[model samples]
Target: MDDVKPKVVVDPSAGFCTGVKRAIATTEKVLEGDGEVFCLGELVHNEAELERLNHLGMKILDKNHLSRTTIGSHVLVRAHGEPPETYKVLEDKSVKITDATCPVVLRLQQKVKKASEEMQASGGSVIIFGKASHAEVIGLLGNTKGKAYAINKKEQLDSIDFSKPIRVFSQTTSDQNEYEDICNQIRIKSSNLSNGNPDIEINNTICGQVSRRGPALEIFARSHDVVIFVSGSESSNGKYLAGLCKSANPLTYTVTGTGQINPEWVLNAKSVGVSGATSTPEWLMLKVAAEIEAMI
Candidate 1:
């Protein structure tokens, strides 16, 4: 039995990406000071990290709560960049805004805002290929002044008026291939409507960090007999990475933490690989690997 114990390996590529690392580091640094630190949203999608931050006296606030924010209170924006309007409102209130927006997201927002401004003059519209209510998408929509159309599924393309000039931008963390497909569909539809050339501008705004994960995780998953994927339920990256792992290895199982790990899943596995989303903490993944070792 000792000789037959499954060999477990944690994926080297798994854990928080550069943006998440920056956000977490900024939060820790802010918490070190003797002041009220309010994060605009969950700094990271991982519940354990949130718990740790909460224990450190970091307060998480939503949009509604943010509206009621008192003047002079310190607010930390997460990696998902907010709209210019949010900054304007916060500035108007004299709130100390510590922006921790990811550079990639910041660039995307700038591009979207600029494109939307250009299109606004021409009676064109901005369309976002992403989850409608996602935090990042919400921020992206803010650049369009509430006029951007968010299409999460291919079927939603029908809602777009192809006759008008269109500019498409994707959420920084959205699936790259899916975004390209959506843009292609829009281009085809617009072309048919115009009988030749379509006035469509496509912006590939997906973060390179997110764009590379699908293929990297696929290889990691295929290298093992069974893959243990860790991520929070509400994390978009978590769901996307887990799906990639599942597609690569049928024996893949997703768990938010160690407690969710099923012994049965590890029983007969010869080799086990552990991986997580961009928002997942390395410490959490280490703990998960230790739990799997204990089970074996």
Candidate 2:
């Protein structure tokens, strides 16, 4: 008997988001120029795309590495958006800076900074709902002069003192539901104290580009028999999208690259779908699709 091949359907929103799009466009434009351009971090989370850019003479610079590099060179900020002081450091070094910070993240940073200033002026504290060590989280903390408390989970809410007025904001890519849960907990905590006054101000600063993926992934997942989620392991949104796919279709598999695809996963499936996070590249997804087709 002959084996049947699986059909592959790619998600419409599988690749780069608006922020990543802007960053890539800026990088490509810079590549057209004659200078040695360095990105503060990976322009996007996809390693394959980064390698491709690397071949084009784009260099990835870590924070420590950046400090050691010669001054007056060109440096492009990634979509994650760096703290204001980062730009100051580059300026002091006479580095020509190309800022590709996502407009949404830039706005979020401004909002957080403004809120923090207000809180500080009123003698209150600022709480940030996000991963502690994430680049975006660090950027958010920078707005508050490193005085913000970063909370990743609901349990972290316990550390906030309800006795004091609180101002809160979320990382641009944080889980929306988790942000809501944190806000609810904070509200409850605030209500319980200070004679039932809800003094906590929670700002929903999560980017719509990232948050919209959840529902879109759910819809896309149901249309296929097996789903392949392609994204970098370091991307939180990538992990979330994979979970959404798995929850929608038990046959879903998350792979960093096409090489990780197991032939057995699609073994009896007719329609196999492919999707990825905002940080993923369209070429990478196409590669994964090609790999799936080749297996079939």
Per-residue lDDT of 1-296 in model 2, one digit per residue for the tens? 65656678789877899899889889888888934688997788888888888988799899877676677678999989998889888988888889999999888888889888887887777888888789888888998899788998878777667777798888888878778888888888888875865567778888888888888899899989889999888898887778878999888888888789999998678889999998999888998999998888
- CA lDDT of each prediction against the hidden true structure: 0.86, 0.85
Candidate 2 residues lying further than 4 Å off, grouped into runs, are: 1-5
Report the lDDT of model 1 for residue 280.
91
Point out the worst 10-residue segment of candidate 2 by lDDT.
Answer: 1-10
TM-score of 1: 0.95
